[model samples]
Target: MKLIFSIRSYDWIDYAAGLILSESDIYHVMILLKDDDGSMCDCKNFCSQAIYEQRKFDLFNVGKKLGVKKLINLGYDADEIDINKLTSQLQLYLMLSGVNEVYCQYSLPILEILKNICNKLNIKLYFYNIEDRKDEYLMVVGKEIRLSNDIINIKNNLSNLTIGRYTIVVNNETKERFYYIYKE
Candidate 1:
């Protein structure tokens, strides 16, 4: 899946995927050692966290270890977010990718704009409020999507991925209701 995870911060890193793989915490990390003059800053692998850490990296194949094929990070200080810029950039980025689905947090007020952009691109964007579990809908999208089986399938897949820790959401309005598993 071509995915973009809106990361809160790098305090919790998913080193296994070299990017923010989850909205939760993980034990993985990546060290992009660079010269004092910033010569190795490739901007490809270096994501929002990498930039915050003063490092750079290739973000395209970041999720190979986590089952996500094309994952990108849109890191930000939620308290000081520029929603307009974020939305515009997000639309551009999605337009340039091969992504079929999107997982975004309803907490982001720009979700409406993001939804419109996704609609234009014919992409499936699933917005969820994971912070709360009593919502009527697991997702919020266009009317057309709300009436399709695509959303239902996404809900099921997300529930399975999260190990049944999610609710199906009757969606009086309406979301990953996803995480990776590993066996040692």
Candidate 2:
């Protein structure tokens, strides 16, 4: 599966780039919202408890626009950065938004805290690492085959055929194959 980690600062783009590149079904985009102090604030609320609700509302609105499945807070501080505190704060925001997944940018401490919280809340935790290269490719070929009404009639006529795997080919090359395992 593809996963994206959205951080709280643009500076994290480099760090995130080293992990993920380009966007696809498995990997999308990681959005980072920077704090006023140029540090990752997790969401819009960090230090002040009074603004927690407001921050959560703002985050939900932004996340909805971005189509983010989950949101993570990367709290940074000059003196001391508390991963547990940040995780707790983010958990509240996620709960309010009805999001289950929380992510981090290679922060082991933050991941551990998220793990504990997920276990307590019965939410699933996913840690995504950037692969060196994409592994799979899908291709669809159309010109080599043609379908007519006769094929539909044939399919209907085969209603009594025992459910099993069948291979249909125009020539020696296999054009289409299907497995009908559960037909009554």
Candidate 3:
């Protein structure tokens, strides 16, 4: 089974698109929620909190879009960057459920922690850039790409692919100057 570990809600859509293309079972899709800054966050308090209305909507829509309804909310935490708590929770979960692979696109602070966890869990960790959003189809599609699908747009924005511990990158593969994220 493949798992995606996305912390930010904005990143969820891209990961969801990738997960969909990867053909990972929706049953295994879990949102590592509650890297959350508090105990009383916009937890399903959608359309209520103006402070986080947009986030709540995004979280709900993204999960629903990915067919992942279950969430692992680490309830009651004040520290925003609580690496220890996050790692511990993740370890416990992995102890109970062995993982086949995990994909995460994130900045620093959690990188080392995630690497250690993946190593301990003995699972493959794929680290694609935040920009490498929706390109699983591009890897397999023919060169004469002419997609006008309503569900997926062909931004062709993938630049790198990380499998295991290796990062394969594009060095002038395309002449296009800008990368675009497919908007839904």
**Highest TM-score, which number?**
3
Model 1, 94-161: lDDT tens digits are 77755666655554466676678889999877543343434333323441122234423332333222
List TM-scores for all candidates, in order: 0.42, 0.36, 0.55
Instruction: Say which prediction, candidate 1 or candidate 2, comes out ahead on TM-score.
Output: 1
Clashing pairs in 2: 2-26, 2-27, 6-31, 7-32, 8-33, 42-73
Error of 1 at 176 (Å): 23
lDDT of 1 at 93: 72
Query: What would the per-residue lDDT of candidate 3 be over residues 1-184, giving only the tens digit for each residue?
Result: 5566665434444434544543546434444443322212213332324423444544455555556545443433334556777788777766676666666656565567778888987877665453444453332111122234533442233211100111123683423122244432
Pull out the clashing pairs in model 3.
none
Model 2 alpha-carbon drift over 4 Å, by segment: 1-75, 130-184
Tell me how candidate 1 scores on lDDT: 0.39
The 10-residue segment with the lowest total lDDT in model 1: 30-39
Model 2 agreement with the true structure over 1-184: per-residue lDDT tens digits: 3334444333223222222222222323333332334111223233443333343444454334334445454445434666566666756744554544433454456567666766777655555333322432111111112224443333333322212112344666553233121111
Local lDDT at 10 for model 2: 30
For model 1 the local lDDT of residue 163 reads 21
**Candidate 3 or 1, higher lDDT:** 3
Error of 1 at 42 (Å): 33
